[model samples]
Target: MSQPEELLDESLRAITERTVELANPGSGRAVAALRRLTARRRTPALPVVVVGEVSRGKSTLVNALVGQRVLPADRTVTTSTWTLIKHGPSLAGQATVQCGDGTIETVPVNTVAALGTYLAVDGQQQLEDLHGAGARCVSMVLEVPSPLLESGLQLIDTPGVGGLRATHRQATLTALAEADAVVFVIRPGEPISASERLFLAEASEQIGTCVVVQTHRDQTLKAKAALDADLASLTDRQQWCALLGDQERADRVVAYFRDVKGISVSSRNALLAQDEPPGPVRDTLLRSSGLQMLTEVLQHDVVAARRRVRQRTELQLVELVLRQTRDRTRETVALLSGDAEAARILEDRRATIGRWVAHGGDLWRRRYRAGCARIPDELQVIVDRRCAELNTDVGRQLAAMKPTEIEKAMKGVLGLPAQVFTELLTEVDTKIAAAAAGVRELLERDGLAQQAHQTDDDGVTFERLGDGTFTRASTNLSVEDLKHATLGGMAGVGIASSGALVLAHAGILPGALAAAAAAGTAGGAAGTGLAATAATIAAPIFWPFVVGAVAFVAIHQVSRVRARTREQARTVLATVREEIAGTALTRALDAAKEVGRMVEEDIEAGIRELHDEADRARRDLADATTLTPAARLARISDAEDLLARVEDLRAEAAALAGRI
Candidate 1:
């Protein structure tokens, strides 16, 4: 194993065994989860989830990947549930359906076409009605015989009807959770809609590997070229351009996939070419269709990405447990030092917190809100200006590139918002930290903590955070319920530098695809990685950010750009700019809402923590006053031992985080 993996593997073992000694309930849960992950690590294959907007050819792409017509894919049919296809001794299918009252029904699917009957979301009401009132198939598992399946790779075909939107919201999240690699299918000229962007943003966090395929590449380009001669289709020489795809936003919504591996493959053509006798026509069709290259990506790029993802997941689990353990230790240390002198300090400190909240809480909240209110506009100007700059740079770069290189060229052009968003979050975190420092300086000026012991960092820490992190920032115990709650499952490890990821209990994080990209280029210390992770989880609005952000239509159609008049190219660039600005503006506004909520939550959290701490201190003080000398010494010694062990684990965690 490589060094990082070796380090992680060794840490996992240490945490699993040593954590059991901590005698903390939270550590017990972490140990359980770590052990579960350990068992799964022995089985290395990560399921690939194939996804797309309605009728974007997700099913077809899955079939292409399997190199067989195992799944039904007709224009009239739409997949409406999760279907897991794995290697089986024979071709067969089974489904799990649920009634409105939440009763589950099992159904046997005997044939390939029958699988379609259970899978279709439209044009098959009669077949669906057979299931009974309020009954809907929630999921299915199909056993398909294929060379691809033999390799232990699994593919999940997602439903198309509510695919990209919110109707099957939880179902979509389930897919995100299970996927180690994603195959995002789109047709020629389809700009990722806002909803698609939202889902991808979340999915990007769970897994860094994605393959974006533009289906109908050959046909769309040909038909589009004919349209340039005044709107024509296969059947009519004067058909409207709308026959090809949605063009109302064509001028404004340029097809852009950012930071993803995209290939334009004609899935239909690949299927047809398979049946043809060995010849140049067949060879050209398969090669030019981009099917061969896509298979390579699935076999190579995406498969390799899964390994890296596993490492990150292991890191997140270990880090969360370590932090929780640290907090427990810190609390223990404070309790041990609680005595006649400490009791007086705690009472006064708690009283001070009470007074501040009563007098200054509302004003602090307002100030934070005011700070957050200006973020949208600031982000808008930056995103707009960035896109505008990219338009010129992209046009210049594209002018000399071949069609095949367009995807490569555009990948570098813009994954807008990801970078801008990262920079913004870093700024926000820095400000929050600085504000905490400023509060400390003010306390020193007034000598409010004049009696606070210099040797006790806890007093300083709690006082500084009394109105900030010290109060509001506590372990969410989120990792115990991690899998379903949010992207925190994917994030907690890398960004614990500020303790924010562990503190915020963020159920949402910005897209990691872009963050990971930024981390690579901005490589410095673990602190930098923490800033990047905070940037992601802190801003969920950008969860609806960018895809591989390349114009795939231009990528596959080599001669099309050359044929376009300069006027047309300029128009395309103009639309690209508008698309970037409009999308960013809408998402920025959404982000502003999250920013406000988080800001308010942070302040409220502080207030809540203050009251809780005060109550705990009052109880601990009473206990301290009542303790016998011998008993007090025993508890103190025990607490000290726990605190030392915790500190050692924390140092180990810190070292590991630095490598991230």
Candidate 2:
């Protein structure tokens, strides 16, 4: 490669490496496509596409350019598919067929006419046949030993469709999109059609260089004059004239074309005299055909134009990578910081849960204590009534009762007050439900109701009581009776329901009553001893006095036992009430704390994930920035020396173009 070509390759290689790295880091589909494009630069092929309407001698022009009878050139629509002709040691051809299953078949090209069987064109098979047969021709490749092909120029002979059919127009436009330069062929006798003009306009936009070829100049002289007049008129238009610029430049262009008759050529005459000896006839035909001048134009001006296209394409690819990298970096940074509105919403939720834990605790404590205060008095009344009934039963049956019957009667009286305690506990559960409702109301007012009830299959919801997370229905305390009330289970009851009360156990009343009864019986024995001592002190004179003292002692013992039992029952009931109230308040407070903790953790995790993504994006941006065209140029050793060498090479190429 020449020095300029080597430098260009170095720059493109640097870009391709950087693009591959970005794609490796999971940059999406656009980056992958860009990588493919950059890789293609390593063996860059400049395509010089030949395009025109059907029967315009485009195939003949391609064959003439290649100096071979390789391409099929006939009056009929012989060139059906896109034919790519490039340099090789010997003449060879191949066809690539795309099958319906996405498989491809690479077959040797035996004859040019076989292409019509796979491709669709005028006078060939229907276009739909290719689809129906589950196969279609993609492209035909021709490798020939031609000097022009060996100069790194690939000639493309595109099918002529006149831009009328949508598929044909698309195929033509696609070829144009990939062309570095274009050769538009027109017959001398015919005027440019609207479709041809449109094709030229679009081709001009995609390709930097375009040369028009007017074929069949050996026809009638009058037709040739009319064609020249048409060319002059077309050249006057700003669209065509702007390509030549000011009057001075226009004059130079007109002078150059005057010698060649406005790029008018006779392919027929040129082909016939290819092997003829040098004589007046050969010289005159060659000169009038304008093929020699067109060859010089392609060798110099077209080659420089192709180089310019390569440079521009490389520059565009670099810009695209930089733009995508910058955009991704910005997006990641925004994610790390988070959305202002969503962050505010999370903060508000945190603050609300915090406030509920603080103030709601005090409110719940007050409600709980007030509701429980009435329980002690209600239980005392039940105890007193049950004791009176027991005393009456003992008075009526004492003389005839057995020891077992008296024991049974005493146990029955102790158990009667259990129902009263159950009622008091039931009332306490109602109060607990009300307190939970208060918590729900507070959360709803602050827009945290949804957050509180959002539960996953693991039952990890915003509202946690103790061990279990509760929904609105399950949190209700009143829905079922408490089977085994414990401090922990009571704490687990969520306060999300208003109408129900959840109790751990209804057995709290019976258990406490049994213990209180046992203590009352022990105290009664002590009271009986004290009463007997007092009775003995007052009576001490006779047997009759002793019997009366015994009866008095019995009555006093019963009264003392009943009084102590009543006092003990009241104390036990009071302690149970206080315990229930305290537990309810503590669980509510804990539930609020748990909710606050969960919210904070979720927010922190989101921020952490965003920060990780941002860090990766920032690193990628740094790497991409380092590989930019300017930065890559700076990194090259002895860049200034190499650049000077490249400039000299470019000057030489420009001089060659000027001479042509």
Candidate 3:
């Protein structure tokens, strides 16, 4: 079992440890997030700071509680610096203060108040210079009041706001932020002044408690009555009850408090009347009305503060889990996209491989046929030469007609149907436009609207976006549009015109001339052979020669047919290339476009995981609590599921990258 105060102290310690873990420099996200988390109700202590008009005894309260008059309380701007008094194990300990020069000064306990003096005399030429320097010139420290070591609370004292001569009001406001609870002290009959109300609203945001105190109640009984009456006059009775709380309405011109015991006393008279001063004068006075009431109220305030701190810590943990889940989801989506892109690239290359095979086969066949086809044309040219050399009338007519026939054949062979090519290219244009439109939609999905390739009046152009996607207008396929044309037309002309010329030239001589040549060859005319003329003409050059001519004509015919075949083959090849390229482009675009969708999907999944983990962690945290000093110390450990969630988020990131 633990005491009430001890339990509170243990809870505070646990909160601080958690805060430290969240602020750890080793954790990238946690370190950055700590500022946002801690900015909201991070402190665990009940801040009780005393404030009053100049020479109205603000530091006196601090000195009384500390059981010493060590704090300067003279008439001439005493306690010029903002001093922070909090509980610690030792009175003299490490204190960190931000000096007026934008630097931190670590000093001992006693010299903490000297920060203002140091800046005023040693560095700043005048009080005005302090205003120019800002909070960097101010110092922060955990001033250990030995009396408060067992109290587990803090007390802050600030200079007067209304009558502190030549001080920056901003500086006073800045100093006031260090306190969690403020005791606003006023002279009798001053009833919640306008300045105090304004101060309360501002301080309420930074500090947890806002209390009003009317000091020097014993100055006059009449004055005490007047104070109560004036408070009623200044504010609506109902509102006053709200600010001061319904409990403290009985006390007039006393050490009044909200939600805690209030007391009134003439402390000055009590101390002076005692002939022998107690060894600890400050301690004796602290037991008096205002200070004693302040302590009691502080204890109550500490309880509420602890609850607020716990709630805030829980909110922070939840936010951390949500953010981590979002990040993991994004990573997973990217991984999937990358994997899909890789697969698409492989598929595209395979298509190119198929095209390569088709084109190579066509070229091989065309080359093989070309040689055989050339023989007939050459033979025909030789026969024409022999007839022209004889200068016969028939030979002359044949020569003249041959040139015209050759010319006509050339014209006919070269003429190609442009309609077929035009239609094919138009089809290509339509399909390309469709692809472009589809890709644009995907780009827009990824919030990459700028990457859309445009076909607007400015002409077709590619636009690039942030996500590494590019857009281009569909290419046209005119004679210039022939990005993938090859050897089809040339093969057509060679086969068509050359074969016709060879056949025409071979049949030039009549059958009677053919018979005379055979007789001459059989009689061995001119000793060409031991055979007649007919044998000479027909024997050596007989069926084998005819066969050779026929083979040449066959090759030429085959070559002519291949001309159209080549064009069709190239068209097929182009279609194949387009299919492969279009598929790849579509896949890549799909992957890129779907990134946001993937992220959304993964985030939902991560949220589910986080919900489960958080529930487990909350249960574990509750179960681990024994609410005893020994047990609390032992069980105050990190949530098991929280640690696992962090690991899970990391693993999710890796998995996402891999899948992509």
Prediction RMSDs, each to the true structure = 18.5, 42.9, 45.4
Instruction: Report RMSD for candidate 2.
Output: 42.9
lDDT per residue as tens, model 2, 1-660: 678766665655555465444422223323433433343345647777888887778878887777776676673324235677888887767765444343445566654455444333321233224433334445567788888877788887877633322223334544554456678788866777654654554354334466778787777566457667756755555534443222433443343333322477778777766766889888877787778888888877666556655554444434344433433333333223333432333344344444544553453345434544454454445445544554465534654666566545444443333233333333433443343344434433544332223333422222322224332111111111110011111211111010000000111112222222222221111222222321221111111111111121222223233322333434433333333233322332333233223222322232233234334444533543456656544433333333334344334333433322
Better of 1 and 2 by lDDT: 1
lDDT of each: 0.50, 0.44, 0.35
Q: How many residue pairs clash in each candidate?
A: 12, 10, 33
* Order of the predicted models by TM-score, top scorer first: 1, 2, 3
Candidate 2 runs further than 4 Å off: 1-39, 98-104, 111-136, 222-262, 275-284, 304-306, 312-660
Model 3 lDDT, residue 368, Cα? 27
Query: Each model's TM-score?
Result: 0.46, 0.39, 0.33
Which sections of candidate 1 miss by over 4 Å?
1-36, 42-46, 51-57, 72-80, 99-103, 127-129, 159-169, 175-268, 275-277, 301-316, 320-471, 474-660
Report the C-alpha lDDT of model 1 over 32-96, residue by residue, as the tens digit: 33443444466755667787776778888788777778777774434345678887788877765
lDDT of 3: 0.35
Arrange candidates by lDDT, descending.
1, 2, 3
- Per-residue lDDT of 363 in model 1: 34
Q: In angstroms, give how far residue 114 of model 1 lies from its true place.
A: 1.5
Comparing 2 with 3 on lDDT, the higher-scoring candidate is 2
- Candidate 2 Cα lDDT to native: 0.44
